[model samples]
Target chain A: MKRRLLLVSNSTLHGEGYLQHCQQHIRDFFGEKVTRILFIPYALHDRDAYAKTARQKFQSLGYELDSIHEAPNPVDAVRKAQGIFIGGGNTFRLLKTLYDHNLVSEIKKRVLEDGVPYMGSSAGTNVSTVSICTTNDMPIVCPPTLTAIGLVPFNINPHYLDTDPNSRHMGETREQRIMQYHEEPDTPSVLGLREGSVLLVEGNKATLLGTTNACLFIRGKPATQHEPGADFSFLLTDTN
Target chain B: MKRRLLLVSNSTLHGEGYLQHCQQHIRDFFGEKVTRILFIPYALHDRDAYAKTARQKFQSLGYELDSIHEAPNPVDAVRKAQGIFIGGGNTFRLLKTLYDHNLVSEIKKRVLEDGVPYMGSSAGTNVSTVSICTTNDMPIVCPPTLTAIGLVPFNINPHYLDTDPNSRHMGETREQRIMQYHEEPDTPSVLGLREGSVLLVEGNKATLLGTTNACLFIRGKPATQHEPGADFSFLLTDTN
Candidate 1:
């Protein structure tokens, strides 16, 4: 069995409903086989509320959503889960919760070893990378370590924005921040996925899916913009 | 001895030279009696170049700036330093470097116990607080911990900006991010220091200094706006 993952840049675009933009993709990716999804709502502040909202959305798509937080044994839940869905919120809080529950390894086993379908958005998408080092969210809490799921070879910077040339903000731009990340020799290549963008990976192959182009950050090189539907599988082979 | 600190929100304002906006404040904070100052340039990607540029700026201000990276013993340098200046780049990098060199405690002792005049801008200002929990910079590197110098009682969110009402960006506003931070019970009140603003501390007293108003975020309460000359000493006493 090959590993399958759908990593989205954001849950919703500007003025869009929760998971509205990616509903069709969600359906197409899972097909008619995946009926139940083990929903990880740890990224959100209100887990119950987040789970309820996600349940409504997933059910409307003709699927059952079971929140991992409500499970008696989260690790066992992952082991038994056919599909996994991680929502977006605060990356630090999400990663910390995952570590606290000791679900990191179990989720990896289910996704990488058992070949269960894995899907994540925003903070969820960020944790699937080599580390949470590229996340844009505030570090409200310190996780045991920055090391994450490493489901993908490269890091994903979700909701990646282009620099506003006319803006007066003095803070480092998104590109400049990624450049700084590359400054550390140990850091891997980063994919700056624009809003509405999704990276679909199956086995060793990955493809960019969306209307807009995604920015790729290679160490010591200029960022290259890849059009939607471009084959990004090359990134999967260039591991740190 | 009373602790003295001048924490500027940013190193440079738009169209301003390096340390240009806060040069007078820097000079006033460290009187003419303090000529030689130890500089921490670890926040930046290029430490040597950052140190050289900072040296020229400090020289123009009639002071000799020595980078801690060049010191044979960084801990000893901090112990003997009359004044300390930390420049801005990335808060995570700054805090990690401080921990790597084991200089956090030494610098805290010099500034809090010995009353050495301490000044920092942007990322530097963020680390002077209880933790680097409210920084706007990307998490380019994972430090051993999020714990910082704890020189100030409350956390500082430097280069804080007001939300642009007309913008189409769907990302969380600065205020919203801080609110998410407060959702965590252990999180402290955040001071949203706008660009060009500075927070001055002497002993137990703290004052907001600059042309613009600063925003204060208290858990379970509405964010309050404080004028430039407002007394913020109360925040100094509300330690986590």
Candidate 2:
């Protein structure tokens, strides 16, 4: 069986009781076959809080806990598991730990090469890009050189929403950023995920789940929207 | 005398009567002794269109148009004039032509090496950067390779605006591209300029002229807003 790549996107999981939602994405993507669920217990002020929080959510999904994979070596922790559940926290902290342990290679092996069912929400999607260019976070928490797992060529901007009137941010709204990406490269599509949106990429095909408000940016321009329950697929021959 | 740079940002020159406003900035920055004007007809659609456009705008500026300066040689064009005016049409077109003619190296000598006063609006500013990656045009116009005059390091994204709800664009916001730029390099700040806004880089200073909504990004994160009239001298030293 081919390893499934489930890229979950919901940024509100940082101490917002949103882990339950993250677990649902995991259950929805992978069913009863997921024996043990492992999470990187790194981001919290208290590291142990992540395991307890994730276990509670995992139990809610009607799955018995085989073992909770937690360690400095995310690659090793993930290798021992059948399905990996990466909960959300500050993208910076999680990325910093990943880089320090040099676990990017092993994690990529487990998911892309070894065919381990990989599940991640929020920062999980962020770590798949070449660099963390689209996250709504400051630069203080981690080194700028700390990039993602390079799952796709483009960056993943999770919990994306257009700007509201009261927001005083001078930054370009979510829509504008994707448009700019279209102007940069017209190939690798930038997936703009709203809450509850899931992009499942198996081999070269990517499908949009949840809301269709999600968009795709090719290079530095926006291509078009992927309607809900719609599938987005491209062949390797088309990309090069 | 040091070489001078005039940043005029009017896509539609006389639209908001910003032409006169831009001219005032030119006079203020380059001084009143600018007699002979070297018009870079490079920004116009064709040499014929370039001549006509130059003739019209020169008449509007209250100066007796002595010569059209329609020479394809940017270096020769600079030698024949006391001052220059780089008009706007499509920045990508102007940049492509400059890169194609190998005249960019000569133009750089006139502006950066020599003390010639260089003035450019819209497309002209786009040519000042090392590449035209940040201009406000469709990326459909692809030049084989980008080589700007190196008047500035990072790409200068001019004619920038905040998204309007009524607008019809489905691309990534300009901010998103700038943020993505940070993931690649923590240097090179993306300068978002609105109409009537100008960026004056001299010695080691980049002063903002226009509204207070200008933004700067570093390491894939939004920095702070730079208010107009503030001396942005730090723009020069804040890079690799």
In model 1, the clashing pairs are none
TM-score of each: 0.99, 0.54
Model 1 chain A poorest 10 in a row by lDDT: A231-240
Candidate 1, residues B51-131: lDDT per residue as tens digits? 999999999999999999999999999988989999899899999999999999888888888899899899999888899
TM-score for candidate 1: 0.99
lDDT of each: 0.91, 0.60
User: Residues B107-138, candidate 2, lDDT per residue (tens digit)?
Assistant: 77777667677777777887776666555542
Model 1, range A1-240, lDDT digits (tens) per residue?
A: 378999999998888899999899999988899999999999988999999999999999999999999999999899899899999999999999999999898888889998999999999999998899899999999999988998987899998999999987799999989999999877789999999899999999999997679999989889999998999998888966
By DockQ thresholds, what CAPRI class is model 1? high
DockQ for all models: 0.81, 0.05
The native-contact fraction of candidate 2 is 0.00
| Lowest lDDT 10-residue stretch of candidate 1 chain B | B167-176
The candidate scoring highest on TM-score is: 1
